[model samples]
Structure formats: structure tokens, C-alpha cells
Target: MTPGALLDLTDATPDPARMRHERHARLVASMREDGVDALLLLGQANAGYATGVRVPACEQARALHRRPVALVTADGADPHLWTWYPDGAPAGLRADHVHPGLRLEFDADARALVSAVHDVCPTGAVAVDEWTMPLRAAFDHPVGDAGPTIGRAKLQKTADELACMRRAQRINEAAVADVKAMLAPGVRGTDLTARLLERAFALGATGNTVDPIWQVMPSSIASGPHTLTGDVIFPLCTTTEPFARGDVIWVDNGLQFAGYQSDFGHTWIVGGAPDATKRAQCARYRAVVDAVVDAMRPGVTARDLTRVARAVEDGRRTPWLAHFYLGHGAGTESAEAPLVGTDLGDAFDETVVLLPGMVLVLEPVIWDDGHSGFRAEDVVAVTETGAERLSSLDFSDYESTR
Candidate 1:
């Protein structure tokens, strides 16, 4: 790891309350730029980002039973949070903005919610994080998708948000280290997954602050040829297949703290030592990762990084080793915007300019038809001058004892 990377990980923490206020301010500015009058935040992440209050996991069960929502005006007014029960409001919420009456009756119609919205913001077109048929019917005014607007606002992270994410990454590293320490021949993928979950909680992986939502995403663990074939999809299913002596172990996992997420992966060989061939493959993958990270900086476009990755791959004798795009932005959601790739296809919008305060993961996947696959990921934050690595865990190959 670079000295700059070490400094980035050890930066001073910021006050959470202050951070929330700054984030809200940015959202308000974004709303103004988009000409939105008010925002009706429906997505859980969107609500949490706008207001410091996060809907607890317990209340999530009532999602269908009732609606817990937030309303923030573009004019920089204090946001309003509506929940079914008064107790559902987070302690951090301001007393004035907490409105418990927005809850609907068991058989109540959408008119009740519509009336509540009108009461909050008397008139004007509203932007909704997610639009539902009922919400559309309730509002007589025009409603537009607030996803893009909110997403753009979230692209830049405040100091406090970065601090929480850094902490999450530290906890994630410790948990994954624990699991790596237990890897050996004959160990099953299920065994590693179990240990990962156990260590995650032991190391203060308290899910997200929104409610102790533990490991909502399952660990992705694969061994032997399964690693190379990419047959084991994410959120790996429980499997009893034993790891072999020379098998590669790929563990792609995630953990969250205070609603922020830490997502990364590392590769290891089951035996204590890797042969020359495996060592070379690991070095090749590391070079790809380093190239991508070096290319990440403010003012660089996603296409620019893609071009650099292509150059690196073209220089390699075996260009077919790379199988996926270089990486994507990481934040509130594991995979966010500003994806870096040559052809992201229809799934991702390929055009985006990298900016300071943006966090992204550089994951270059390498695979072969019958051999094993290898990949290492590192999280980086675009800095004013360049890029700083947020994830401190080493991506180099590790050899587990037998």
C-alpha cells in the first residue's frame, strides 16, 4: 500500500450530525438546479440521506402495512418525516419535523396520504425518489423521478460520510482477515461463509444504523474450478464442496455501518504456497488493479479509464484474461453511478466525469475457460489532487496453510 493510501484510511473522523446537515444542504441545492419544488423521498436510502432519521428494520415490516416517508422542500426548509407510529421516528430527528399521523389506517385509501402531502407542501410539482401507482394517483400535481436528481447529489460524499465509510471498511477488513485465517484444504465454501458471518458481528459489523439489519447480503464464496468458471453467482448458496490443495478461494463480501457500506473482495490459494504460474497470474491481476487506480482522478471521464485499461490489457500477451469492466462507484448502495468501462452495455450509463469526493471500486476480473479465475478489488476516493485508496486491505495473493 502507498503512504498516501495509509493517510487516507487514517484521516480524522467528522461529526455525524454536521455531516447529515451538509448532505441535506447539497440535496436542497440539487433540487433547485433541477427546478423541483419539493422532494417526496420514498426509497429507504434516499430518506436516510435527506434526514438523519433512518427507518428501523422493525418498521420495514410495516412497509406494506403503512408508509414511512420524508418530504424536503427545494426552498431549504426543514424536512418532514412521516411515520405510522410516533416511536418509529429516530432519536436524531428534530421534534418539529416528526409527523406520526401520516400513517394510514389498515383499510384507508390513498386519499389520506395525498391529503397529508398537500398539508406538508400546499402546491407545486413534487419529485419522488420512486413513483408508485398509488402515489401518482394521490398527487394532482406533476411528479417526476427523483432518482437521477438524488443520485447526482449523492455522488459527492461529505467528510462525515467518508469517515463512516472508512470505519465500515476497517471492520470489513478485520472480518475478512478472520475468515482468511481459517482457509485450508478440505474446508468447504459453506464453512468460510459461516465464519465470515460470525466474525462480521464479532468485529462490530452492526449492519447499517437503520436497524441492526445483519448481513442482508450473503457472502459470495467459491473454491476450485468454480472460481474460474464464475459459476457461483453472488450471495453464494450453501455448498459442501471441499476446497482442494491448489484451488483458488474467492470471497466477495460486504458489511455496513451507520447506513454506509463496505464492499470488496480478495483471492487466496488454499495451500501455503503458489506455483510460478499462479504467482504470475496474481501479479498480472495486481498490475491491472494498480493501473486502474492510478488512472482515477478528478476531471477524468469513465471512458478515459476504460481506454487506459484497454491499453494495459493489450500490452499483456494474453489479452483474454480480463472478463469484466474495470469498476464502478461505491457508496450508499454497493454499486452506484460513474461506472468505468469500455462498453457498460444497457445496464449502466457509460458517460460520467470523475470528481473529487467520489468513491469507486477498481475490480478487474481475470478468468480462463477451464483454469481458475482471479480478481482483487480496492476502494478509492477521488481527491482534489488525485485518488486515495479507502480500503487498506492488501489485494495481493495470500497463501493459506494446509
Candidate 2:
């Protein structure tokens, strides 16, 4: 068999500090426009985006390729990083390269973080990404009320972010092919999961989720919480119900290498031909994904794309399309904003158009609740004319090798 090569794939490149500076300036303008005094990036993703630091350990898991947080003021002053990680951490190195003027401090101590923010920008209504409490609360203060600032900024993706996302997509595609090649007719999900992990490590991923992609949600089988336990895997192929003549194998896996993630899923048939009903259902789901891609032009909203996906799924009585949202934004984190869900309104919000440089993972699945399911996911970049598929595989012909 051919060995995996240490190939250097080109990634989205941006002047990290310059990007932060521009964002700060935009925030300043936004503050003036919205009448907000300052903004505090409480969520790790937002904070890292602003200041170039990885703060929360949990969020750091996804920070395999990027910084953790950036806190800026309405005036668009130099952002500060809140974290205990020394300057030696990867995030710190990234910050150093891009944001030489950024401030760095630890939030747990309270004195430094709170004092620094107060010293820099004391007055005005503070805005924060309240949804990201896991990384927030580290630097609590008696300042102005924190509003929704980071969420607004995060909803939109810059050119640099899209580039990084494209690289992640390439890495994920390679890892998936490598891992799937190791599977046999009756390979246990646990074993297959480990093989995928091995491939990810070989490809230079900083960190990975303990749970295999096949066992995760929207893929079907509900395995036990913990990762490995004597190989009684629940999702993909099981020891009890190993790959049968016509079993469908869906791999909903992810890879986070160098602080970026590529989350996508694909389906395969066991040894023999796939079931007719399932194949048709997969076809419908694939068409739905295509519809979303076709409608993903600039000036389109999550609502508009979601409508297309929902319409296709509703057209068929398939469970996959109806149960889950079409797709979501991908970057330093696996799941981000601008999601296509039922919560969307009448039309795609022109306010949040599908602009160039935004990287997205389109995952439209059909879940069997307990018995079976099928999914085909791919990472794509929003170009000027339309979206570009980043995966090496032809999503139109996604199939299982085993």
C-alpha cells in the first residue's frame, strides 16, 4: 500500500495582527454606529479572534491551529489576550507573529484581567458573546452591561478565516480516505475510530475528539458516552450486527489539525449492493445538498438556503433531511454561526449574505433514529460567483469502500 506523505498543503493566510487591527477598527465604527461604548470577547473563539490567545482549555481542544480569544474596545484599540498559557504555546506564537502590540494576561487571578480591561476602556455599554459562557466569566467586572457584540462579528467570516478553513477541509478529506481504507467487512466501530485517529495524528493534527466521527450525533447509533470499552461500539459497525450484506455505513467524522477543524460525513454500503430505499433516500439528501450549494450565492441568507434544503427534504418523507439542519459555519471551532435551521425566518437575511472567503460544511443527513442512517458532508468555500467544494471526494458519488 502507498504510505501517507508529509505533504504541505497551502492554507488560508492572513496577517493575524492586521486582521485583529482591522476588526478592532470595525468594532470601533460599530460601537459608534450602535452607540455601544466597548466590547468584551468573553467566548474563547471571539476572544482568540480579537486578541490572539487561547484561554479556556476546553476551547483550546479546538484551537488546534489558531488562538483562543481577543478582547477589544469600541474605540478599536489594541486587543488583549486572557489566558494562563505561556508565550510558548502555539496560540502565543501566532499572536506574536500577528499581534505584537496585543496585551496578554490571566483571567483566573481577576486582578490583572479585570484591571487591564477597566484601565483600557472604562466607560460604555460592554458587549460580549453570552452564548459562549464556557470561555467567558473568567474576567468578570463591575463595568457596563455586556451586550451581543462578538456574535455579530463572528457571524461573518474574513478572507483569512476562509483560507484556513479550506486547508482544514483538505486535511479532513485525506484523513477520511486513509482511515476508511483500513476498514474490513466486520471491523468494529471502535477499531475503525482508532484507525481514523491514527491517520489524524500522522497528518499533524494538534488535538482530536475522543469520540469517533461515526458515533457522534446525526449519524445514528447511540453508543455509550465514554470512547473505548472492549470494542462494544454502537454506531457504525457493531460486533453484534457487523457489516451485513446490505448494511449502510455512514462515517460522520471530524479532524482538527493545527487549530482548525474540517467536519464532514460520508456514507458507504457494506459488501453487497445497498438497499434501494436507502439509496434513493441518500440520493434525495444529496440533491438537497446540491440545492443548498446552488442557492449559496452572495446576498443569500441562512434562511434562504435552509428553505431550499427543507423543501427538498419535505418533498420526500425521508428522515435524514427533515431531522437536521442543512449545515453550519466552520473555522477554529467545528460548529459556528450562520446555521440553516427551522429557527430561520421568511427569507435569507441580506444582512448576512453568503460572501466570498466564508468556509462552510454542508451536512444534510437522514437519521434512522436507531436502525440506520445516511449522510454526505463536504466543506466548501464561498466564492464570488458561488460556493466551491473543498473535499477531494466527489460528494455526488460518496460511497463506503468496505
Candidate 3:
């Protein structure tokens, strides 16, 4: 049995200072174009992208009050970060630019934040990603939504950003190795999450973005959780339900390294090898991913990817979850722009033109109803010629000897 290797994987490294510098430059350039004098980033991913702060794994509510914030100016100076994670701050960030976490729940804190923004821009416009009532009430000047400008800046990744993603995938795949080694008929779904997280943190994963999904799918959609669309349910919460012989487990997980996220998904058969029909599903899924990856190049539209994937499906329901998407961008956020085949529809897809340096995570599901199915994510970095595979898991590449 063989495992897929990280494409050009690197060993351990220090903070990615150059990546942070380049990202800050992009943010500044975007802010200047948008006429945004200052950026007040409260969203976790946005803040991380602006400042390169590696926030720890925490529940969302807990992360909110304690989350790091970044304030970027059009001057192209270092982005100021207010955070509880002083160590996670990028090495090149100015010492004066770092500060303690702001507790915006307090009125004074909200006013202080407004003051901070005013300090930088004074009369110029400030852009904000999120806002609290307190923050909104305290503002003395007009502001724009930071999402548009920030999204534009982050659409294309830099060389160092690709390196960080590669490092992240390497760590995530290593953890999956341990989890796969322990799979057996008696193992429970939550049990797999335990091993995955344990191994990930041990291998240097900085955070777990979402609870691992180890849903044991049924033979058909009816036998699974009831859905409005009768489509096969995926990603049901992980539970202690122990596995039996030939249980089909759909594993999906996300974790972080230096603020960049890693996405992983694969179908694992318990106790026995995949039957012939199951292998067919795997083959179809692979074909869809291959077609999409082959078509990944600069100027390609997201519609082209969905079209190729649908051609492989041959009129079957879209190869991805109806509720989710065929592919999404992976970077500071687990899922971002350029999503393919989502509810946004064909018009939206046409507008999303692929650019070099955009990372795409394509997860195609091949569910052969009565026989069960296969789903897995393939992460690729769009390049000038085509795309580079970032993830290491291939459903055909057995992770362990059974």
C-alpha cells in the first residue's frame, strides 16, 4: 500500500515573514485603489491575512472576545495587530504595531477601537469587515465594507502562501496517516476524530477549524438522515457509533498551520476492501477531479470547471453536495471566493475567472445509490500552465496495510 506524498513538501520552517510582507503589500495596494485609508479587520481570517497572526484553536464564541484584530493603512506601513497571541505575530511586524487584545464588549473598549481607527485615518474613510452595535455607535466617520477590497487582495496567493499551504497539507496528511492506521470494525466515529486531532497537534497543526466528520454513510439517501432534497447526507456530526464490517465512512476535516487552512476528505471502508461497485464510484469521482484539475489554468471560468465535472457525471446530479460546492478557495479561510457550482448559480460561476496562484479544493462525490459511494477532496494550486496538487491523499493510494 502506498500513500500520496506532498508535492515539493518542505521540512519544518520558521515564521513566513516574506509571505506576510507580500500580503500586507497587497492589502495596502487594494486599500489605495478602493480609497480605503484604514482597514479595521474583525473577522478572524481577514485579520490573520492582514497581519499573519497564527490564532489558536478555540470555539467561535471564545475566539470572538479574544480574537486578534488587524488595522491596516493605505500608507503601506506595517499592519497593527491587537491580540492575545503576541507570539503568533509575524516576525517582521513592527514592535510598536503590536498591542493587547481589545475587549469590545465594554463601551470604553469600543470607543478605544474607534479612536484607534481615527488615529490612523483621521478624516479618511475606514473599511471594516464586521461590526458590533457598540463599535457602530462609537464610529465618528463613514466606513466601507472591507470584504470586497480584502477579497480582491487575497484572491491570488503568493509564493510564500503556497509554501505555507504545502506545509499545512503535509502536516494534515501525516495526522491522517495515524488515524488510518487505527481503523477497524470496532472503532467509533468520534474515536477517529480523537486520533486525527491528537496526531495533527503532535505534527504541528496550530488549530482545528471544524470538528472532524466521520459520518458512516448508508447504502442510499433514504436510509440516511432525512433531507429536504433526498440527496445523500454527508458530514453528519461525529458520534461514538462503533463501526462494523464494511462500514462506509465519509471523513472530512480541516485544520490550520500558520493561519493557512488544510482541507481533507476521503472515503474509508472498514474491515474489508471496497467491493467492485464501490471501486467504480471511486473511479468516477477520480475522473471528475482529473477533468477539473486538467482544466485549471489562468482565465478559466468556474463555469468551465463545473461543466467538465458535469460532463463526467453524464447528467447525474452534480458530483458535490447540493448544500455545499464542487470546489472552493483555500487560504486564510477554509472556504472563500471562486466557489464552483454552489447556489450562486451559473451566472456567478461565469464571473469567477481563475487566476494563477488561486488555490482550489475540489471534492467530487460519486454516490452509486444502492451500492453506496465515494467522495474526496483534491487541493490544487492554479498555475500558469495548469494546477499543482497540494493535498496528499488519493483514495486509490492506500494509507495503510490491512
The best-first sequence of candidates by lDDT reads 3, 1, 2
Cα-based RMSD of candidate 1: 5.6
Q: What is the C-alpha lDDT of each candidate?
A: 0.67, 0.57, 0.86
* lDDT minimum window of 10 residues, candidate 1: 209-218
Error of 3 at 200 (Å): 1.6
Q: Pick the candidate with the highest TM-score.
A: 3
My TM-score estimates for the predictions, one after another, are 0.81, 0.73, 0.95
Q: Write the per-residue lDDT of candidate 2 for residues 249-335, one digit (tens) a residue.
A: 667766664345677577766555455656666777678777888888777777677668778878544323433456777766677
Q: Count the backbone clashes (under 3 Å) in each candidate.
A: 1, 17, 0
Candidate 3 residue pairs in clash (backbone atoms < 3 Å): none
> Which model, 1 or 3, shows the larger TM-score?
3
Model 3, residue 188: distance off in Å is 1.0
Error of 3 at 348 (Å): 0.7
Using TM-score as the measure, name the better of candidate 1 and candidate 2.
1
Give the lDDT of residue 289 in candidate 1.
Answer: 66
**Best-fitting candidate, measured by lDDT?**
3
Residue clash pairs of candidate 1: 228-373
